[model samples]
Target: MSVRAHIIHAVTTSVSVKLMRGQLAYLRSKGVDLTVLSSPGEELVAVATQEGVSYKEIAMQREISPIRDLISLCRLIVFFAQKKPLLTNVGTPKAGFLCGIAAWMTRVPNRIYTLRGLRLETSTGLKRAILLLTEKIACAVAHKVICVSPSLQARAVSEGLVPLQKTIVLAGGSSNGVDTSRFATANIEKHTDLLQRHNIPPDAQVIGFVGRLTKDKGIVELVEAYQALKNEFPHVYLLLVGNYENGDPIPDEVKTVIKRDTGIILSGFVRDVVPYYTIMDVFVIPSYREGFCNVAIEAAAAGKPVITTNATGAVDTVLDGVTGYIVPVKSSEETRKAIRTLLCNPELGKEMGQAGRRRALNEFASPVIWDALYQLYGELINRR
Candidate 1:
């Protein structure tokens, strides 16, 4: 019954605190001796303190560097050899690849790879080939691959990255499900001060987005769509609630527009994003791909209708036309039309938002995902 588990990610700030938020703590509560590993940072320390779990700082690079990667790989092997954990649930591309090999070499009984998203989906040529090979090796060494969404699972299987039997999507499809209580409809009226601070007018319709402001996140298309949308609804505001990643930089012009446009409110990397959802009239995640649009469901929980694309992980987030519209990726026209439809019909938007909240409560709540994950962990440990 003693279950020692280690969760590994490339960085602590983004993945550990954001994507995998509250997950480690929940697992710890369920009699798991959980330890988190990521590159050293203040956020890593904060996460350990907040989650009340032990952690080890393992220096790992996000980008592909042969020399650094080998050093990181050796460090991982040593960690696994010393800790001898019953299960090691590794995630993010770099950590997964290195940790998978280390776990396999150290003969960890239950090696679980949490496949969040495939970078290979967007890459081409030499980079794509490298990503594909590493991902395949990561999956090959793992006892189980937990895909965050059904579509991601399907894509991995279709690409021969992982067999269908080895990959599974937990509960509905989200790495860490949305916290319904924090983003409930009752709390919608509580963020008036926040809106006031941002100088967002009470009467102005707000279009919100909460993710990396990067090219792959469909930021270019979103900017284009918002520009077209402004022609119809001048009083509208685009509230971006995340930071731009240096790795996948958006065009210089797009960045300029985002910075200079008076109507666009940019709040870079807010630690607590729950209240910001309340300020939004409609939320959009025009992403090229996702593990599962966590922000989409969070918007739903906040009683806000969402407009997302039919990308790999994004396609599974909404009910389409009922909860939100699913527009084609890279199409500013379709995105504009969806935004226009919701803006023009206030009643329809409200109804859809209500429906989305219901869906989030029923399927994508944090406890639901945690329970499923706990059961899976027990099953995996028992099998070994």
Candidate 2:
């Protein structure tokens, strides 16, 4: 079972490394020599220690900066030349583009660009054109492109970002599959302390959302939907588990509502989201786009019915009407209707939750995805 290959994975920022939580360790256990490269931060240091892997820090920027980007590219080329890794797998828009070129320049036998999401999907005019060009360049230099979800893969091909032959979706559709055991339903008593700390009433039905509270995440629509239902459903509480981001900021008016609304409890940036999921009766992710909505699957693993949009990765997370309802992106009315339906018919929500849990266990388990990825890597390395 020895995999005598050296592989380096890169992302733009340290926080983005959370997307691959247990994945690098899994690859290491299968005997692949692994190294993580990202911008310098405590999270990166922590990941290196926790996963028992070597790491390199490169100050990569998320935004377009011509001067800094050129400097970063030069550094990447030097790093690749020094490491000479058998495979270079890079993700995040910035890292993917730079590392793809660096890996190609250094003649890395297996180059991979992990297509997380297409920012151009939401951009327009000049910005959209720039994003599209960068995506194509990243894909052009990489030997393989790993789209996290089936829909994302299809979108990449449809948009001509990458050819069908160069892209793949491992197992079902997730970057790192859900840790079902950690996210499953917990003892009611075990959640009491967390509920009390958050000041959530025990009898209140919670509608939860996780991930950044940004414009693209459809936070404005989520707020609108919750406000619409608030009067009719007095006991229903909206709990947002993540913090706001400066980039793609939500409308000021929407932010004001989220803060002023008595029913909405904002729990900014939690390390352990599993506990929060246990407190939720139903989960909602109204994102406009995603590579794959990990939180939606995590909610499913927690045995909660999910309401997400038909946007790329989000669309694949739930089985419409079965595991959860699928609403159109940015439709507050539809989002509100879906929320009301679940809140009114508790039994239907329970049924959907159970079905979602079954789907999570059967299709999106971590080991299943890790094994699939390992096999793919093995095939690629052997070809080299």
Candidate 3:
């Protein structure tokens, strides 16, 4: 087991490059030969160039399509057999299941499944069963399962998806910890034009969110909460940094409300989120589920306090009353209350934001997580 051994990392979509970029580069710098695989897209090309790693595009659909899945599975088996990687780490639901089975079939010595989040958490009936079954099979085939948060690992074990012995959380649980330097307040002035483009007043108190605008992300409740906050605080503004996703969409009524509101600024799917974070006075991620809310810590790294729901991985990103408030999942009233609390007491919010910055630097720095991952890979390779 040498650093020269081939290692393949697979994800369902190119968007996952945001999470794996730092780790891939870190491993490559350590002299490990790495190959990245995902569905073809501009993100895939960008990540490959950014990390200086070899990449292969494999078609993968996020939704269930039996015929397409079968074809993808067969293709993966052939690809795995050809590459014969010494280690294969697969992530996201589709890639995890397909690549896990393919790696096992090809007798790849070290197979790892990175369980970011469990879709079964929000799904119901037949969909829940299928998601759970896929998770079980993915875990069964992998030599190890790396959960991004302690709570996620606990839930998976409790649900019998993976045995506790095979699962572990690395370095306080984040896929790639925040780049503190990149997300700092020093970069705020560079993006002031972003405020002008969105027509957001310079002095407005901005409450921001940076994720897919979907039901699972608690977008409906967030809108309701925002509306309530607007009535109370005229200077308050909502800055949503992501786009509406087709899968698990937010209700049309919610979208209508967002469109009707002048105070809510939607910057759909921006490539660089740092500047958007700078414009935010307070960050909110009212997600109903998460595997570790990366955006919360990124906001924290940007010197902004966060208000997130007390859902599994979401809870781990903020220190309840210290870094910011934690409201119950789907509770717009509580979310509104937390937002009001931060808004009324700007001093308190500033104190919390400063605390959050310290916490992000101490607990979730990118280098720390990358070093832990590099060591984990070395240990797994030696064991194999």
Candidate 4:
């Protein structure tokens, strides 16, 4: 039998695909067996199938479901046992923890838990404790722990979540780098029809946000800032590309209010986000926290300026006042100022956007990240 590896996760959103896309292609090129296991609701199954990679759906909920959790855990244990994968890789917090637990129980040869951001960062009280415990459990189970960001890796060790000796962070800590060649400004030519179909005019200044629409993502703050600046900038437009699941942290009232606003256009979720980036004059991620702001990098790679919070992963992506401004999280005043500054100064935006593209090519290119993962996989397999 060929050597098989399993990449497990919850919702296989754009992010899941972005992080694993290059790695999957590389694995296939090497004739390594690649199987992705994710929650039942994801579009990953279909996409992976088309790529000739296998997928298995497991019971998963974005939020806690006590009874269902038990059933899911049992099913995962059996699946791991049956597959006996040469390697087991888990992602996202809940999925990481559950898969880590199952991998440990089955004594999988090479177990990896790739921790992105701590979901517990924004939690409180007893709930926070539970989240922390789960993280520890997941870290303990993995033979090797993967922390996507240096800041997060430091936090993990300091917080007593993962041992210093067992964890590794690769290439400045993005889950994976952007496909620079694909996201280039030239590629936008292919997306001309996408813009027409979306009813977006050729000349509108599209300010876009891509991620789960939630409180933690600072959707409310984004709206307030956009509301404050819209009337002043007549050609300005807002595009929101994401879904609003019940499991999301955003308050119902906030979601209702934002969706009803005529100024903002919700595209729900699109498969190929490269076109959207091409149409956008500026890409904004006013998120309160992030593992690594891949969108900011992608935006920069697409030759669009970015505005994000001065938080963990974001700081690495943006060059303050150069590539874009890094403002205080949850502060509408700062968010608006940054956005307006970019709009009023198009040349600066273009310059910064160009700088970001160079930076991405040097530091966050797909090959740079793929080589790192390929080497890591080789090391782990060799050790076994």
Misplaced by over 4 Å in model 3 are 1-3, 189-191
- After TM-score superposition, the amount by which residue 136's alpha carbon in candidate 1 deviates from its true location, in angstroms, is 0.3
Cα distance off (Å), candidate 4, residue 178: 1.7
Q: Candidate 3 lDDT, tens digit per residue, 1-384?
A: 365878999999998866787788888989989999998888988988999999999899999999999999999999999999999989999999998999999999999999999999999999999999999999999989999999899999999999999998889888788887786556754367888999988888999999999999989988899998887888899999999988999889899989989998888988889888888888999999999999998888888889999898999998989999999999999999999999999899989989998999999999988888778888999977
Candidate 3: C-alpha lDDT: 0.90
Worst ten-residue run, lDDT, model 4? Answer: 6-15
**Which 10-residue window in model 1 sums to the lowest lDDT?**
6-15
How much is the lDDT of residue 246 in candidate 4? Answer: 60
Indicate whether candidate 1 or candidate 3 has the larger lDDT: 3
Rank the candidate models, highest lDDT first. Answer: 2, 3, 1, 4
Task: Write the residue-wise lDDT of candidate 2 on 22-58 in tens digits.
Answer: 9889988888899999999888889878998899999
Summarize candidate 4's per-residue lDDT along 320-360 as a digit string, tens digits. 87888889988989899988988898898889988887887
Q: Per-model C-alpha lDDT, please?
A: 0.87, 0.90, 0.90, 0.78
Which parts of model 2 are misplaced by more than 4 Å?
1-3, 184-190
Residue pairs whose backbone atoms clash in candidate 1: none
Looking at model 4, how many pairs of residues clash?
0
TM-score sort, best first: 2, 3, 1, 4
TM-score-better candidate, 2 vs 4: 2
How do all models score by TM-score? 0.94, 0.97, 0.96, 0.87
